[model samples]
Target: MIKKRTRIVCVTLICSLLLPIQSASVKAADNNGSELSEEISSLADFEAVDELIEQRVDAMTDGDMSEYHELTEELEAHGCEDVSAQEVQELTGETSQGLLNSQIQSRNNISVQTKGLYSAAASNVTFSKSITNVSYGGKSYKVMKITASPKGRGTLFNTGSVTQKYNSSIKAGSLNLLKIVAKKAGSASNVIKLVSLYDTVCSVIRGFKSTTKVEGVEANYTWTVEEICSFIYVYDARVKNYRISASYNKAKYVVSMNLPYLKVKNGKSYSGITHKQYSDWISAQNYGKTDKAISCFKQGTTYNSWVYNVSMTGCKGKNIKNVYLQHPESAMTLGYWN
Candidate 1:
């Protein structure tokens, strides 16, 4: 009877202990979950900070310094110090940001490789990384902030520039870039060498040769950048004025001087839509054309980029064939708070 009693008491004690332990474990899990949620919430604050900085910079010199000044105070609280107007003048010898990297790059995604143009030069043109101070209505605020890489996009190879590079960067079989168009160097003599990079034998590799007649005209197949380069190397010089169109959908740079400042995203030509088509879509979104290093200053958003739409001309000065090398088009989405 005593043994039985002891056993019952032990079992009850064990059960009692386990109940608290189990409850504690669940509580720990809840605590951990709460911490994880808090961390995720904190990350969003950084994004908010970046957006606020963009807005502050945009309104720095709009004939009223109160807003700009208020933004400066807010930035200072966030650890992004504003460079005084004196400091900016000392750097560029001009009022406002003469030409800083931050001024040209309004987005977080850069479209090309910048070869250290942020350093000042003898010329008035410059691309600095420091915050700028602008004055209006007898008041000034530090509008620009120290240049920073996008949330997680800091690398030597910028993804936004993949399309931009093909515009004038790729070298097929040539070493020297004598002409504006990038193609075979030295009469395309090294076509075999170029092909050897991809295949075992020095031979061109083509995919899906489609010769369809589009409205009575013989339309050749669309090709990738590599395939086109290969074709150019193995192309018969005798067949002059031979034309083909190749396109990829990704981000490419667009240039229009009509708008003082314009920002357009990469898009498909077939979609029949562009930031250009709508005035409401584009305004004051200025990304500098191209730096000395052929890099387009880009930031804010990630846009798709693949190169196409390139034109190479020859054929004994005959205008009969018009070969258009197209770049990749990019797709993007705009978010509205309302």
Candidate 2:
């Protein structure tokens, strides 16, 4: 009787374990079925969207307004009401209106014959063109007449010209305009302004110096405009035979010669200077000199650490050199001075 009781108890325990295993298996099967249904639905949606896009492409290529409206209705019925013309073009490689305009500009066979180079001060420059046959929309179209004008920002020293390539077949005796404006490339004034700004900054750097210890030796030197512009400053303490390395904020325009100084300690340079610390140091300096330097140019502005906005008025003043001497300590500092 005890053996029979033991057997019944074992069977009950086994059934308890088996029940959970059976339940887990059923749950897993349910999850898999749900995933498969979602996947199938997603695929169906994709196929429907693709078909609608193709229909739109065909309609656009054929210029068929009726077919385009029919496709739009079908797309709306399929819950794709938010699909746009741009989206359809993106999916099907079909050309949008902007793309059509770009194609006309890039591929049109139109040549301009100017009497001479267009003058900046001239109100208008008349030119004639020989228009060749262009293949567009599977039809050969020839340009009949073109109306040209000035199109871009033109200063008294620089000018822009516009040329139109037209397809006369669209409307009989009327031009279907394909406008292409080309600007004359010249910045004689900007070059002059840049030269003047560079000369002023160099002169300022040449005159300024700070009495400070660099790499454990006293040095009477300050960072140059070029070094600051390059975003790194290096000077040698010739007496100590050690090199000093410090980085400055190039964007500040008038960077301070002091603060966050580094020295070569035991052949390794150490500094407590963070980027924010150096920037703050620069911010404390007087910008009067920098502002004066920039004012020497017509349209001079500081854009960032790397870009300086310098405009050209005209090259009239004598050119001055922006020179910096490479320190002898530069050779020992792993090519940092350059």
For candidate 1, write residues 1-338 as lDDT tens digits: 24633543465456446433121000001211221111111001122234344444334313346765665565444334433323323322222332333434654553433223222111211111222222334643222222221111121011111111112221223211111122221232111111101121113223201221111101111111111110000011132111111111211111111111111113111111111110010111111111100111112122222222222221111111222222211100000001
The 10-residue segment with the lowest total lDDT in model 2 = 35-44
> Mind sharing the TM-score for model 2?
0.14
lDDT tens digits by residue: candidate 2, 1-338: 24633543465456446433121000001211221111111101222433353445345334687876676565444323432222222222222333334433654552321111212212321111111222334643221111111112221012112221221112111211111111111212112112121221223333211321123211111211111111111111122111112111111111111113233323333333322101111111221122222222213222112112221121122111222211111111111111
Q: What is the TM-score of each candidate against the true structure?
A: 0.19, 0.14
> Model 2 off-target regions past 4 Å?
1-44, 83-338
After TM-score superposition, the amount by which residue 21's alpha carbon in candidate 1 deviates from its true location, in angstroms, is 33
Q: What ranges in model 1 sit over 4 Å off?
A: 1-45, 83-117, 121-338
How well does candidate 1 score on lDDT at residue 49? 33
**How far out, in Å, is residue 39 in model 2?**
20
